[model samples]
Target: MNLIFIDSIWFTFMLLPFLIFIARIADVTLDTLRIVFITKGNKIIAPILGFFQILIWLVAITRIMKDLDNITYYLAYAGGFATGNYIGLILEEKFALGIQMIRIVTQKDASSLISNLYEKGLHSTSVEAKSNQGKVHVIYLIVQRKMIQNIISLTNQYNPNAFYSIEDIRSVDVQSERINTKQKKYRHVGSEK
Candidate 1:
């Protein structure tokens, strides 16, 4: 019985490092999500994610403190954090939980592109501007991040030479009619009450 007890204890010690590694991964992933949500002005969900992140972090830290002599545990914790950051970024991309403003400048006539955007349910404002080259049309569009690809595809189809820039939007006080319609289809991350 004594020998069996000693073996069990040894086994548990051997397993501790992996367990700590997993916990660190979980906490850091939550930390990444929480920070992203905070930046996006998601008041409702950011705090919730932060709470869980800290909780998991505490658990992992406690294990590390208990096993101060184990170099493996330290390595596992650091490795998990690095891996978690990559995983978190991938998850954020998959979620695409925010809005972006896209600016398109093109020398080509923008009427056709604007009409195409409208037809596709994307609202945009076009202004005639003069650049060093010549007269250009600047088109501004605010859209969900998930729809960026669609907008890009449309732009490429309409005017492949159009210069475009995309910026992350923290909050939009007023949304266009088209955005309102699209908002009904997908839940915006921070828009929840």
Candidate 2:
């Protein structure tokens, strides 16, 4: 007697929007986590994220397929995608993974800070550049997330009025070379003997 195959409870259709919304949240969250894992070079977690991401995507698509005639289902599907992107970005910001290059510029020369950073086993490069005020010294360093605060503090201590910015670095190799300064320290992997 019933043309619609979905039985049990017709009222269950009412919950479709809520379910879709949650699915969207999960899908986006999965994507964000995947990116974070990849950026951090987490081989194990990346695969796990990919598995969950595709799984949620399939469930969302299946719901849409079953209720092709329902307009609310369509809305939920679209809304989920949009919300997922926003959620993914928010999650990425919360978890700052990956190598980052920090460029610190100060109105005054920060030779002391540079020396301190070198002693701490960090690589750096410095150059003279002109800012809105006058000539300033700019120091660049590529470091991991955990060392970000320490670098920032050194920047502040060296030059309070310095302008600085941090950005993600896609790749770097152990053999990479840097310009030499008196404070620079070279690391030896093993004994020369």
Candidate 3:
């Protein structure tokens, strides 16, 4: 304590950079998730994640500023940021936490697909729209994010050559509140008869 200064050569060159690297990784991962939560309209969790993210960020930046001449710190910070983004995306995909809408545009009939969806307790609506090619059935449905693969499989089974797009459902009304709770007991389980 009396002889060696707190910013010793070993600490500045080795330990400090390592600590900064780890801190940056944690901060950026939390930041990525925080942004996702915000986009998903999660009011409570985003701020909590933001709080921890910034706290770790401040600690890391303070270290970076103290050793501005060191290039190792910069490389570590950048590498950590990139790695954190990759990990965060993987985690987000694994979580799959939201509702989505799948729209299938097919020139063929959608009755079979609709029936299959109904059997699976999923609701679907079909509209006969005139496309440039011919009449198309624009079949659409609200689906939980986890069931997206199943929906794609069913569409492939029913409409072999169908064009489909999936979109995030940002909000739902009181009528369809079941998307957020009690998915199994959703009162309106099937589309219009």
Candidate 4:
């Protein structure tokens, strides 16, 4: 039984494809994270992730090249790529690595929304502008990416008719007023898993 498992067509077709599939999932997931880090302006982590992504990719591709005629390997590779994209996006969301700027425009009085934000320990800038609608209050908040949904909830609760847009902030002057000075240790997420 040991000999059969060690040297058999079962190992070549089944175990080999499974290995390739797992490897592709890992490498592609790493690639996705690397891209996210790059866009976030993280110079150190991006390159480290990229190195492992390419390394695993080369190993997986070499195995597939050895058995080009095998349909199972192709299926595994394609499936892993697709699944990796989904899993990578989920992981990035979980990591929530970066800052976001949210711009909110409302026709209603923004005092309630501003108060809600302040109560939540979030700082925002509000300006009164004249639009075709006569007057509008524009509020801008810069916060960590993870806090986006909570902020949105506050806006929806206070100003249901508000128009809000979110954008990724590539860089921000940390020394400026209204920016949170507390240091967040993001490395905990990566090391925990």
Candidate 5:
């Protein structure tokens, strides 16, 4: 009986650190994502993530408090935090949840680039502007974050030396006509049935 009791105690001591490590990683990852959502002005999802982040943190801290003398638990907690940050950044990159505004200025003729963008269904506006070097064409395009790479490729193909800058767009007001048209089509299909 004494041997069994000792074995159980040893098992628990070994298991608690691992469990704490996992919990810390989870909570920190959620925290990182929550910050991203907040910056992107995602009111609904940000609060939900924030709630869970704090809840998990409370649980992990409670365990640490319970065993103040455990060096292994502290190390696990710290290690988890470091690993969580790396994982969170990678996940955010994979998600690419937002829009970006890309501005391109080219000294060369921009007609071909503009035409290619229109052909690819990427809307852009071009303006004739003058620079110290002479005439320059400025093109402005707003696209989903994931589409930035494609835009870059098109720019490189058209004007490799074009000057371009990307800025994060917090929000965009899309025209309601597109949504209404889709709804009307759906209604028409349903009526036919």
Candidate 6:
């Protein structure tokens, strides 16, 4: 009886870490998918993913409770968790689910390029600043990820030597409702000009 109890106890302890590790990994992976889905404008899929993620985590935890002495299991569990998080983030990035802000730093005058972008139905802001190499005109635009190629083409045309940067913009809210109308008119007027 003593040996049986000892064995059971040892088993439970050893496996606890592994169980927790696996459960966390599953949970985080699901969260990563959920965020991606939300960003992609898919309202239905994210919740479904959350449901399965929680269910898997519950099962994993229950198994860990039954065996506590499995040290190797515990270590493996933790390792699996770290690996899962990395995998989840990579998978999410591969999906690329949202709008991005593109910033262009040009070594020369880029007002014409900015004017062209606005003419093409994109909103842009341009400012003149001094850099290490001297004065530069920086242009900022917030565009959908798919529009980046077009923007890049414009940048190459206007400022081949211009430096540029792009970053993901998770959410946006335009405070001025009139801005859209103004942008549309700006495009139409530029075309006619």
Q: Which candidate comes out best when scored by lDDT?
A: 4
Q: Write the per-residue lDDT of candidate 6 for residues 109-156, one digit (tens) a residue.
A: 887887788677777778999988899988888766656776787788
Residue 92 CA error for candidate 6 (Å)? 1.2
Question: Model 4: runs farther than 4 Å from truth?
Answer: 1-6, 181-193
- Residue-level lDDT of model 4, residues 120-184, one tens digit each, is 56788999999898799999988888877877777887778889999999989988868742324
The alpha-carbon lDDT assigned to residue 191 of candidate 5 equals: 28
Clashes of each: 0, 0, 0, 0, 0, 15
lDDT of 2 by residue, 1-193 (tens): 4545436345445576669878977887788789778876788998998999889989988988877887877787788878888888877766656667889988776788777776666779889888788888888987665467767776777787778899877666746655222122432222121
Clash pairs detected, candidate 5: none
Cα TM-score of candidate 1: 0.87
Instruction: Give me the candidate number with maximum TM-score.
Output: 4
Q: Model 1, 80: alpha-carbon shift in Å?
A: 0.6
Candidate 1 residue spans exceeding 4 A from truth = 1-14, 174-193
Q: How far is candidate 2 from the true structure (C-alpha RMSD, Å)?
A: 7.7
Question: Lowest-lDDT window of 10 residues in candidate 5?
Answer: 181-190
Prediction RMSDs, each to the true structure: 5.4, 7.7, 4.5, 5.5, 6.9, 8.2
Report the C-alpha lDDT of model 1 over 114-179, residue by residue, as the tens digit: 876765556788899999999999999888888887777778887899899999988786544545
lDDT of 4: 0.85
How much is the lDDT of residue 2 in candidate 5?
Answer: 71
| lDDT for position 45 in model 3 | 99
Q: What is the lDDT of candidate 3?
A: 0.81
Give the per-residue Cα lDDT of candidate 6 at 29. 86
Could you tell me which residue pairs clash in candidate 1? none
Q: Residue 148 of candidate 3: its Cα lDDT?
A: 81
lDDT of 3 by residue, 12-43 (tens): 77877888888888988899999989998999
